[model samples]
Target: MMESTSLYLSPTIFFPNYQNMLNSFKIYMYTPPNPLSFSSPTESLFFSSLRTSPFVTQNPEEAHLFFVPFSSNLSTRSIARFVRDLKLDFPYWNRTLGADHFYASCAGLGYESDRSLVELKKNSVQISCFPAPEGKFVPHKDITLPPLERVTHASHAPGNRTARYLGFARYNGVKESNLLNELRNDSDFLIESQPSDGMTLVGRLGSSGFCLFEYGADISGIGEALRFGCVPVVITDRPMQDLPLIDVIRWQKIAVFVGSSGGVKEVKRALDRTCKDDECEGLRRLGVAASQHFVWNEMPQPYDSFHMLMYQLWLRRHSIRYARREFV
Candidate 1:
């Protein structure tokens, strides 16, 4: 776990504003009737964090934002039901039509039921693991959250740059990528057809200069590769896939991005070009630093995954609405 006092861990630009966010931003968390709604391990941690967070306000009138405690697997019907209950039981939902409300969803915004919840989905911001622009996500309005897995491995410092493999890539699910197939012959790349059920690739990942992780429903691989200091080479057509802290991080400095249109040769070419560059070392060094954001701690750190997500929420702080007339 990263210590909150580490001045050197976070990116230089994260400061001042990071401090500002902690100082002024206030979020009011609604106690949903279903306390069991926060399902995942990460979601449970986040919910617990909010309960003890200094940012949480007892008074909704003073809050800059509101939180829906449920995590992922949220359907429009379920959310609609929850909001309907809120509208009936409280004044906040009806006041601004939930414009200031938000919730986290690990399952991307592609749920068919999402379309059915017209009034609520339109106004409420979704901090989703999957942010497909074609789906429910409204660009800049919603945030792309990387799956926040609890990392137990000690943080490895980036030092020597003597990785044996040029790159590493894998074929996920049933269909093998044409790009991966071409690279299997290349000794420089460790291309595997096996499913990533475990961290079998971690050993190779430590020695690889770049990890070309194709974006899929299972996005955990991206974070796993990043944890070991491998520069992530994300291949995806989705506009904002595999991105967190999109507004702040200069991700181009830390990873290689090849579009879905790019072939294995193109991927190899990009890796080859990056491998030769002097900046590649810097990117590798930054990859170690950037990986810190994917980690979660029992105690929240300064710019850890928790703080970073909070910062994103702070950036997307919607219009403040104090509905209760007497309180206003």
Candidate 2:
């Protein structure tokens, strides 16, 4: 089925000032005193997107926010050191004490609450993929990046499928437990530890009514299922807010998240509820619509991942005080 545009799911519904944000929102990007290596694909995308967008401002005095771009895999202490150098070299850091600064990182952050980096971690806004402290990242202060590869289009549509459920990818740690031992003999489930000769991974996802995922374990799989128009039945202990733009996107509409602590029967019950009630069609449509939010474009499109990130930055513009300079 072809999916219709969902106006209610649009970010503008919550952020009515998006147009004004385009006109006025200005970010001052700090060129590091030393060269930085952007090792991860996620960091490279964010670095390029911010530079190409109109939100960047050359003049720091009039800027609403400051962006301090860094590379992946850097120790949190290294980041704090980088911030320390900025404080000595630039006047802006002293005025706000890095309160108005932000960075996008794929590296895990907030694990170490080092005394020196406390200001940067607690005061500055962190946009991260592996946001720490488990289940939910702190909102109104931080944004979780959609961990994804670059995609230009979404063309998949929901259709008749052969399997009731498909486990199309390997779990992060397979030794933890064998999934659905009770259904090992069942044909309705196409569960595999890895790909077999029957069909391609993408093919399996497309032909299945629902996909299973262990959220926070293999999050990229969630992106894949959405792109394929398969209603994702996620088994996770994580909060719904752990997802990108969950406050506005209504992830519950597109996906079902079951707690991992629940036994095998719980998984069967959830899947039965979705398929037997005839809700997969609507769920698939909304899941397809949500695919747009996980995509990264060179130039941000409305409600795309980059644009959604900008909305988060816009919401956090007031976290720090921007003071005016005075001359005697």
**Which residue ranges in model 2 land beyond 4 Å of their true spot?**
1-12, 111-116, 130-139, 150-154, 158-169, 172-176, 180-186, 193-199, 238-240, 275-277, 320-328
- Summarize candidate 2's per-residue lDDT along 160-249 as a digit string, tens digits: 655545434444454444455544545666666645532466677777777777655555656667877777787776565556775457
Whole-model alpha-carbon lDDT for candidate 2: 0.68
- Give the clashing pairs for model 2: none
The reply for model 1, stretches above 4 Å from the true place, is: 1-13, 71-75, 108-116, 130-134, 149-151, 193-201, 260-262, 318-328
Best by lDDT: 1
lDDT (Cα, tens digit) per residue for candidate 1, span 155-247: 564356468988887665567767667677789888775535444555667778888877663455566667677788887765553367776
Per-model C-alpha lDDT, please? 0.69, 0.68
State the lDDT at 217 in candidate 2.
57
For model 1, state the Cα shift of residue 254 in Å: 0.8
What lDDT is obtained when candidate 1 is compared to the true structure? 0.69
